[model samples]
Target: MSKFILNKILPLFFLAFILLCFNCDGRDSIKKNHTQVLEENNLIQEFSEQVTYIPETNLETVTDTLLSSGYKIHIKTYFNMDSSVLKTRHQDSLNLKSYYRNGLADVIISTDDNVLFSKTITKTFIRENLSKPIEGLKSFILKSIWIDENTALNGTVIAIQMEYCIPETQDCLTFKLSVKTSGEYQLKQL
Candidate 1:
């Protein structure tokens, strides 16, 4: 009787161990499959579609509404004093040139590497002889008033403020311009 009982218990224990091992393996496989499914579906790509570009016509309406809502659009452009070439450090200043001149800037809108709509703004700029142009200029600064996301179009509407300054003159120019960028802009993500 004792021998027979020992035999039964040993087989039961061995069977239980094998079953647990198989169960754990099955769970791991399920987890892997779930991960693969998620990767295939790619949440980032899905989220990209939800973001839409504001049409050019809509942008005008939006800008008008924003202007009426007491939102002042300020842009500053820093030139090389004489040349339209942008300063390396102040490259962002040129984003609104079209807007300041025509009240709009043409922008390429993309969603997750997908190009949506390309449009321009109506911001315009007029610069006089603010300073003498310099040659072989090294660097400059362009700063503009901050505009929130809602007031501007879906893309980035950068306000250019400063022009590149030469080492000798240390003078720069500012122009008010608006740049319109759409679809997956860094500002939109933030």
Candidate 2:
């Protein structure tokens, strides 16, 4: 009888206990998940409080259009969504997508009569003006743009702000690009 109890009953008891643990949703796993979510929310609030507030251009988040002295200047920035390499490539190769997404813009300046200047600006545009290269920047974006119309002070009619950011993080560097009415531009760290 003792042997039977040890052989059959003990195994059944152990099996029941294991199933109970697996079925319990009110366990430590749920507690840990809840704790992690709370921590993430706190971190988000902290990041916002520490960072300088910058306004976002609601117009496509990448498009800016302004009219100055009868010259219509249009700026558009886009990410290369056609590339499937981000999905197919390994983790180490994912950084390549950053180049396609960030640091490229189509700048067009035209008037009611004809197109004056049309060019695609690339990463070299930023690197040439920067004293030192920005390291570990996963992506960048044209955060906002506005017509200053104050060419008398700095020969810049339009002022643009661009942000360089780490992937999925709050770390970033902001740059100010001053653009003249004649379609020429200059960049400086801000």
Candidate 3:
């Protein structure tokens, strides 16, 4: 009788051990899944925070009309190549100029002979030296302009430029300016 009881008790203990292992495995899997979900949520939140929001506008016609109306316009310059230093020659030349505020190029917006807005941006020519090929450069300014505001109508303009210097050369490259306008105007979406 004692031998029979021992056999039954041993089998019951084995079964309990197997069930405990399975339960532990299931709990581990759940914890892993939970951790992955939390990490994904954090990444999404971080990405959303990095996003910038811009208001919509329709302003192509208005900008064209403004341009045709003889409003002095200029675009910010950008360096197409890769570099961050400025050539000495270009820096000296810009320093001698006085028309633009702070001796920098400016985009001028005016109406009826009154200056509406002007954005001045300092640009660097990326070059190893004054005679070297341009690699790229950096700009220190960014500006957004509002062109018009009326009932059921609004407009905005954006302009940006950047420059850089090549290594071991004096030559520099200047990037073309980028300009955008939006509002009741019919501007192309970028």
Candidate 4:
């Protein structure tokens, strides 16, 4: 009701969520049909954190959240991919390849009716952490987002971690973002 439900602030993760959907061809796939479609469109992948598939739209919402130190942290992600990239089951018949992947991450930090932080971070957020900028128009996956209480070891109010992946070469990088109660945050390449 607060608007963030679908399009408002309540929206965008994985510390980890393995999607296992029917592959139409009788094989099992880690990605749902709708997820594949969104990636192909090179658009924002729509879905909720729910792992269940919606036959009608093949989408749910892809988001993760946690309550910590009086602040609520929500991490939402949208996957992106290049249409040219073709996906095929590996010999294992499970893992995906060429599987171009990219994503948009929305991190929302709030308390009660007041919002302290909201950011839609892209690969750029972890740019400095990458060995080199991936060249050409390719796909990247906002692999995962999670709350890391271990950050308490660092004395921060809250710590969030996100992983960016490039399925083409099976490369992924995890980055950590921490915010103070004041709503300030910085991305650190973990």
Candidate 5:
């Protein structure tokens, strides 16, 4: 009678232990799924905050017009659905020159793993020595007059020119910069 009772009680105890393990496993799986979802949401929120939302403009007409005007383009950067600079590959480059004179910031479109595209940027400091300011120039503004996206079938390109200037002294300096969009938007020392 004692042997029969022991056999029955041991089996019942083993069954209960197995059920508890299954329950614990199910709960752990749910917890893991919940944690993954939270992480994704946080990433999305961070991306939204860093990116500027711009509707995709038709580059067809703009390309034809630029081409007919005898202008050639070689796009240096490519645009994508992900417009967040924080999540882009060029985050380090973007953060480096994000700010300029008078508290101006950059608008970048990263292309490759280490490439960035900025529509316009101001030249305030001397390139030879960033600590020193440009002589007689309070601000040298460079603008993107036209973007020729169709120039490269497989890729996109842009042409940015520095046609404007703001001189601090009476003497005026006139210069223009025309370079295709590429790796990093860096201004050559003038």
Candidate 6:
């Protein structure tokens, strides 16, 4: 009688244990699904699409292509622009406007893979085709209120503040360009 009871009760307990194990929480799958949703929604893109920078030197042994020697200046730009929703009656007008806003700019100067200087500029705006129809809206403009440049001897360091406007019209936007250091190798800036 005892053996019969043991066989029946043991199987019931074993089945309950198996069910519990199968129902246990598995968070790994949940996290993976969340990431997939973000990618599908265009909330996060691959690194190449968002990161841009100038390399110090480019040496292609196979193609024999070479870049000039100098400190490589890397500029990474991030902007929140919803270009998908832009609509205009004129097809050409749609092509002329830039929807760049809330820009974040990162600048890094490096040589031989060693970082020499780094700076970040935020709260910048980029607009294209800001002119009137008569004047022809054919320009790309960057505007930033916070801008300055430092100079060094034997090197040209210039930070220019530019806002080109039609003197007859008040249509204008701000821009900043800097060449912190210019030499045989560090002559390029953006």
Number of the predicted model whose TM-score against the real structure is largest:
4
TM per prediction: 0.19, 0.43, 0.22, 0.49, 0.25, 0.27
lDDT of 1 by residue, 11-120 (tens): 89899999988787655456565436556668533432232111213222232113332233433222222323322221321222111111233333333444433433
**lDDT of each model, Cα atoms only?**
0.35, 0.54, 0.36, 0.57, 0.37, 0.39
Q: How far is each candidate from the true structure, as Cα RMSD in Å?
A: 19.1, 11.7, 17.5, 25.0, 15.3, 16.0
Q: List, residue by residue over 44-156, the lDDT tens digit for candidate 4.
A: 32332212111223122455454535566666665443322344454432343333435566778887777777888776556644554545324455656777767634544
- Give candidate 2's root-mean-square deviation (CA, Å): 11.7
Which is the winner by lDDT between candidate 3 and candidate 5?
Answer: 5
Q: Which ten residues in a row have the lowest lDDT in candidate 3?
A: 52-61
In candidate 3, which residue ranges exceed 4 Å CA deviation?
1-67, 74-103, 113-117, 123-171, 181-190
Ranking by lDDT: 4, 2, 6, 5, 3, 1
User: Model 3 has how many clashing residue pairs?
Assistant: 35
TM-score of 5: 0.25
Ranking by TM-score: 4, 2, 6, 5, 3, 1
The Cα RMSD in angstroms, rounded to one decimal, for candidate 6 relative to the true structure is: 16.0
lDDT of 3 by residue, 1-190 (tens): 8887789987898999999887876554565654365565685334222221111221121222254444444434332222222322224213221111112334555555565445554443212223444223332221222333231122244332333223334433334333334211112212
Off by over 4 Å in 2: 1-64, 82-103, 111-117, 138-156
The per-residue C-alpha lDDT of model 3 at residue 47 equals: 29
Count of steric clashes across candidates, in order: 28, 0, 35, 18, 3, 0
Winner on lDDT between 1 and 6 is 6
lDDT of 1: 0.35
Q: lDDT tens string, model 6, 32-92?
A: 7654766766754441132212121221111111114444555555443421112113242
lDDT of 2 by residue, 106-135 (tens): 766666877655766545567777777776
How does residue 170 of candidate 2 score in lDDT? Answer: 71
Higher-ranked by lDDT: 1 or 4:
4
**Cα deviation in Å at residue 130, candidate 3?**
24
